[model samples]
Target chain A: MIIRKIRGLFNHSVALVASLIMFIPVYLVVVNSLKTKVEASSMGAGLPTTLNWQNFAVVIERGKLLTAFGNSVLYAVGATLIGTTLAALAAYVLSRNRSRFNRFIYFFIIMGIAMPTNFVTLMKVMQLTHLINTQIGIILLYSATSIPFSVFLIYAFVGTLPRELDEAAIIDGCSPIRLFFSVIYPLLTPVLITAGVLNLLGIWNEFLLPLYYLNRSAYWPMTLAVYNFFGQFESDWSLVSADILLTILPVIIVYLFAQRFILSGMTAGSVKG
Target chain B: MKARTYPFYFAGGALALYLIFFVIPSIMGIFYAFTDWNSYSTEVNFIGLNNFRTIFSSGAGQNYLHFIRNTIIFTITTIFLKTAIALGLALLLTGGIKRLSYFHRVVMYLPAVLPILVVSLVFKSILNPATGLLNTFLRNIGLDFLAQRWLVDIHLALPSVIAVDTWRGVGYIMVILIAGLMAIPDEYYEAASIDGASGLDSFWHITIPLLMPVLTVTTVLNLLYGLKVFDIVFVLTNGGPGRATDTVYTAIFDEFSKGRYGMATTLSTLLFFIMIILGYFVIRLMHRETEG
Candidate 1:
């Protein structure tokens, strides 16, 4: 009993130390974001002598965060809706039919999960399509990039759903589109939500796409905006921290709420369970 | 009836978008790799083996091969580090300590959820050589000699980048591993114990064998993510301290920005083929798992 107790205590301390190591960076950001310029210069982990509530306001005004925030919302939401819906439709038919061609298409699309974006040639395609520096272009790109993983998740999910639902609707003389929208689509809620939330967060946190394509600040997402803000205010740790805080605040909130789905979704295909 | 119920056009939207944006560009990149496609001129000249030769030859200042070496090192190191640490955490949380395990898992996984840019930027501040938190704490603890330049030194830069990335990524791998660990039945261990098998023996016999599939999945995931790593290295070092940390992706970006489109496409094409070949095996493995 004494040995077991000692073992338990040792494990607990190890877990605690690990968690602290993980949380310290976030802790540092939270504390330094509220400090004065001089105190925040080093970006230390010390507590603030006084909480500067106005720092957020200062960052908002100077960082153009409002526009960036709106743009992020637009991109994340717009892309999630389009990407998830299209992926579901595609995954459903491919899973249901199981034809040689459909199977080939399914593999082809999901192969993108491992495929790296050839950005240099993608530039030419973007210009040819006249999407370079456009908000709509960014949305389409995010949606396209998201299709691979979304399709993979939703494809696996489509298998768990019985095919009887499809036959039943067909026997009722329902149109194909009607059967899908009215019956099959509604049953896909859980997977849709999982795919949607993951894509939302993924698109929200994305930096590379914007860095390569979106040159105009008017269409910059929070990630790009915060990066630019850091470049300008690199020395001002307080303000940079504030900018980063505001940028990630939404992502943290969403993750906390939808973490159940996010965690399950992330682990879905990797583990059999 | 089959065609009518599940119309082929339903898949058309995703197929079209993917082909146009994803596939076509990659195919075009293969062609562009052999040309002197640049922003300097409208006419793209065929420069057959020149770009490939440049990457292979390693001229006076060009370190294309070095960049590839750095990427391989980053990928291998991160995979080993993340897998080992994550496996330990998974075991600890699953069997070692039962209390507040969920809370601990959540806290650990927080960094993976945050933007890599944010994490790298914050790490930039923490890793500062002078008056930085790491150096300050080291000096305060009377270990001043232990404090060294974290990101500036060429030899230390890649390792520092790898360490920061490991910190951000281990939790994610741990979550997947926790699931894998939890799925193993308790009976296996109990049976082993009854047979007089020691703890280490059972772990080696039971847990390791059972967890092979998940381990393979996690390793492949890590491999893919590591090969394409850019954001962390970009924000932290930008392949800095004299290109000591430039990976393939960052090197591509550098070439692209320099208007050397031919070289950029060549490098991108190289990674593309490597990933596609690896991706082929990965998809086969994953597909088999789902099917079986």
Candidate 2:
């Protein structure tokens, strides 16, 4: 009994240490963000003597975080809605019908989970489509990029739903569109939320897409804004930390609120149960 | 009846966008890889195998092969490190610890939710050689000799990037492994114990076999993410310390920024084919898992 108690204590300590290591960087950022510029220079783990709340205001002004925050919201929310809705629609039809062509299409789309974007030629396509450096373009690109995984997740979920619902709706003279939106879509809420949260967080944290495509600072998202801010104020650790804090604040909030969905979505296909 | 209720056109919107934005660019990239496409040149001249030659052959001041090597090394190392550590953590949380295991799991997985760029940036400060938290702590604890230039030395830069990546990623892999571990029926362990099986025996005989599929999924997921690793390297070192840690994706970005579009496309096409092959198996595995 004593040995078991000791083992339990050891395990708890080990878990605590691991969690601390994982959190140290965040702790450093939070503490340093509130420090004065001199204190923040090293970005140490020390508590600030006086919290500099003005750092946020300075970062918001100098980094143009307000515009970036708005852009991020627009892109994440817009892309999530479009991507999740379209993926749900597509997954429903493909999973239900399961025609050979549909199967092929489903495979082709999910194969993109491994497909790396040829950003060089994507530039050409973007320019050709007049989407390069445009807000709508970024949203569309994010939505398109999100489709594969979204469809994959929702397709598995679609399989779990009873086919009786679809049959009943069809027999009641329900049009296909009406049947999907009015009946099947409501049932898809859980998976839809899972895919939406994942996509929203993914889009919010995405930096490379905007860095490659969005030239104008006005269209830049929080990731790009924070990166650019870091580059400009590499010396001003306080302000840079503040900017990063603000940039990731929304993501952290969403992750905490929707962690169940995020974790389930992540492990959906990887683990059976 | 199926066709009437579930129309094919419903998939059109997603298909169109994906094809245009995702698929077409990749196809066009293959063609452009054969051309001398650049920002400076308006005319894209066909130059077969030249970009490929440039990548394969060692050139003065430009080592495309080195970048490829770095990418492969990064992928392999991160896979090993992440899997080993994650498995350990998963086991510990599942069997070793009982109290607050869920809370610990949530805390550990927090890093995965944070943006990689932010994580890297934060590490930039923590790993700072002179005044950073790590070096200071090492010095304070009388471990001054261990305090090395984390991201500055060419020899250590790649490892540093890999370490940061492992830190950011291990939690995610652990969460998946935990799910995999939990999926195993308790009866297996009970049966093993009844048969006088040791813990190690049960782990090897029962847990390993049952967890193979999930392990494969996690390995492939890590492989895909590692091969395309960019934001971490880009933000942390920018493939710096004299190009010590440049991966294929970072090198592609470099080539694109330098107006060498053909070379960039060539590199991307190379990764595309490799990933597509691996992705085929991954999709097959995932599809089977979902169905089963």
Candidate 3:
């Protein structure tokens, strides 16, 4: 019994130590971002000696950080709307039918993961279409990419749903659009939220597509703006760290508020991702 | 008749868009890979195996093969370590180690929510040879021998970058494992205990086998991402320390930046084939295991 108790204590401490080690990188950024350049250069993991909030202020001022933040918010919200709606719509059709066409289409969408890296010709196509460098263009591209997983995921859940629900609404004199919005849409809210949260994070965190397509600094998304800040001051560790922390803070805050659906949605996607 | 056609109308708009934007582009990426399609040139010519030969032969892209090797190393090693740690931690968090599960989850998961660029910036500063937090602490405690130039040193850079990536990624794996564990019924462990099974025996016999499908899926996805890694490497080393950390994708990006469009597409195609083949097998193997 004594030996078991000793082993338990040892295991507890080991786990605790290991976890703390894992968390050091996170804690380091949070603490140092609050410090002045002098303090940041010193770069201790402890609290700032002077308790400076000016680091964030400096990053905000130098980077037009609010404009970038607002731009990202606008871009992410729009992209999420398109992605989730397209996904849900495609899912609805696939779920309601037992046709080979639907299955083939559904499977085809997952290939987006396989081959959709940066395509310069696609950029040229966008330019020729006169959609290049516009927020709408970026949103359209993002939504297109979001379809596969969305359809795949929503199809899995939507299949378990009863078709009679749609029929019941139809008997009550519902138009096709009304039937979707009123009857079926409400039923999809949980999965929609799952898909929405996933889309929201995905669109918000995406940097590559935006980097290629959106070149205007005034319209640059949050990631691009932060990356630009890093570029401008490649050797300035203090300013770079400060900007990095500021950029990640909003996402982390939003994530804390919606942690539940994020994990489950992400896990659900991972099993097939 | 209108109702019969309603479903087609509903799926038509999104399906058309998906096909045009996704399906067509994917096929086009492969076709372009075989041609000498430079963005600068007005007309492109066919370049058969020249681009591929460059990757394996000793020349401009020889380092990409090294990057491929590094990426493979990072992916395989990180998956093994992250899965082991996540599983053990998930076991502990599922009421075994007792209490503070919520607090621990939030702390561990904080990294995953942060963007990769931000994570890289944080680590780049944190891993500096002088006055960086990692080395400072190591030196303060009289463990100076362990300190090295982390991201800049050829010997230490790739491993150091992988370590940071693993740190950010473990929470994701742990959360998924926890979800997988939660789905398993509690009665199995109770029944096993009643059969005089040891804790280790019950874990190995009941818990591990049930978690196998999720684990397989997790490893596959993580490994694929690890192999095709671009963002973290782009922001962290950008194939620095004399191109020691160059992954094939990063090399492609450099080639693209240099206006070597045809060569870039060649590398991209190579990556596309490698990932697709590996990803297909892993997904099939996992799906089969889950169904069986």
Candidate 4:
């Protein structure tokens, strides 16, 4: 009994230690971001002697975080709404129809899960369309790239609903569009939130696409802003840390409030698909 | 409002966006791969297999073979470490530690939620050779011999990149495994205990077999992501210390930057084919499992 008690305690401590190890990087960023320039250069993980909120102000000014933050919100929201709406509409069709054509299209979208976006060629295509280095371009690109997964996710969820709902709505003198908007779409809230949150997180955090497309600082997203900021402020650890914190702040907040939905939604897609 | 016709209308918007941006670009990518395309060239000429030959041959300091080797090393090592550690952590979290498990899960998962760029930048500073926190912590604890130039040393750079990738990734995998572990019924363990089976015995006999499906999913997910990994390598090393950490994706990016558009497309085309083969197997496996 004593040995068992000791073993349990040992395991718990081991977990605690492991958790602390996993957290040290975050802890370093958070703590150092609040320190003065001198204190930050010391590179110690200790708390600041005084709470210096000036770091945030400096990063906000230098990094142009406000503009970048706005761009991120616009891109993420625009892309998510467009992708999700299109995907939901398509998913409704794919789920309801059992035709060979519909099946083939559904399978084709599923193949995109394995397909990595070829940004090398994508850049050339973007140039040809004159969409390179533009917010509209990034939004359109994100929406397009995100369609496959969004369609697949919504298709999976839509499959779970009974065909009776569609039948009942159709018999009640409803057009297909009206039937979708009034009855079927309401039933898809859970999966919509799932797909929306997942895509929002993905588009918001995406670095490569925006990095390649948006060369202008004015149109840079949050991730790109942080990257460019780091290049200019590499010597100033405190400022860079502040920039990092600010960049992730919105995402962290969203994740905190929607933790349950995001976690379950992420795993649900993987498991079910 | 014919039901059948409505379906076509519904799919039109998504199909338009997908075809123009995704499908067409993919096709264009391959076609361009066979031509001497570059930013400087007004009209691309057919180059046949020359771009591929450049990669295959030892000319122009291409280091193509090295990139492939490094990619395999990075993908395999990181996947192995990430899966093993995630499984270990999942087992521990599920091993009757009830009250604080939620807190632990949230804390561990916190990193995975942060942007990969942020994670890479944070680690870039943290692993700095001079006055970085990691080395400072090591020295403070009298482990001075263990410290080395982490991201810059040719010998240490690739492994350092892999370690950072595993650090950021293992938490997400652990959450997946935990979800898998939780799905497992407790009755099996209870019965095993009643029959005088040890903890290890029950874990091996019951848990391993039952968890195979989830494990396969996790493994394939890791492998797929690993094969196409770019963000972390780009942000951390930029495939640097003289291309020591270069993967195929980074190689493509570099060639594109240097106006070697045809070469870049060749690399991209090869990667696409590899992905298609992998996708074929994944679809087959999933279909088999679902059917059975």
lDDT score for candidate 2 against the true structure: 0.92
Task: Give me candidate 4's TM-score against the actual structure.
Answer: 0.96
Residue B230, model 1: lDDT of 95
Local distance difference test, each candidate: 0.94, 0.92, 0.76, 0.85
**What is the alpha-carbon lDDT for the whole of candidate 4?**
0.85
Candidate 2's TM-score on the B chain: 0.98
Q: How far is candidate 4 from the true structure (C-alpha RMSD, Å)?
A: 1.8
Residues A1-273 of candidate 2 have per-residue lDDT tens digits of: 999989889998999999999989878788889999998889988899998999999999999999999999999999999998999999999999999999999999999899999999899899998999999999999999999999999999999999988888878989999999999999999999999998998899999999999999999999999999988999999999899899888888898899888888888857887
Model 2: residue A167 alpha-carbon error in angstroms: 1.0
Q: What does DockQ come to for candidate 4?
A: 0.61
Query: Highest lDDT: which candidate?
Result: 1
Tens digits of per-residue lDDT for model 4 on A150-228? 8877887787899887787777877888978888888999889888887898898898898788888899998999988
DockQ of each candidate, alpha-carbon based: 0.87, 0.88, 0.46, 0.61
**Each candidate's TM vs. the true structure?**
0.99, 0.99, 0.92, 0.96
DockQ of 3: 0.46
Model 1: CA > 4 A from native:
none
- Candidate 3 lDDT by residue in tens digits, B140-242: 9999999899999998888987888888888889988888888788899899999999999988999889888789777876877787788888888998888
Per model, state how many residue pairs clash. Answer: 0, 0, 0, 0
Give, for candidate 3 chain B, the lowest lDDT window spanning 10 residues: B283-292
Order the candidate numbers by lDDT, best to worst: 1, 2, 4, 3
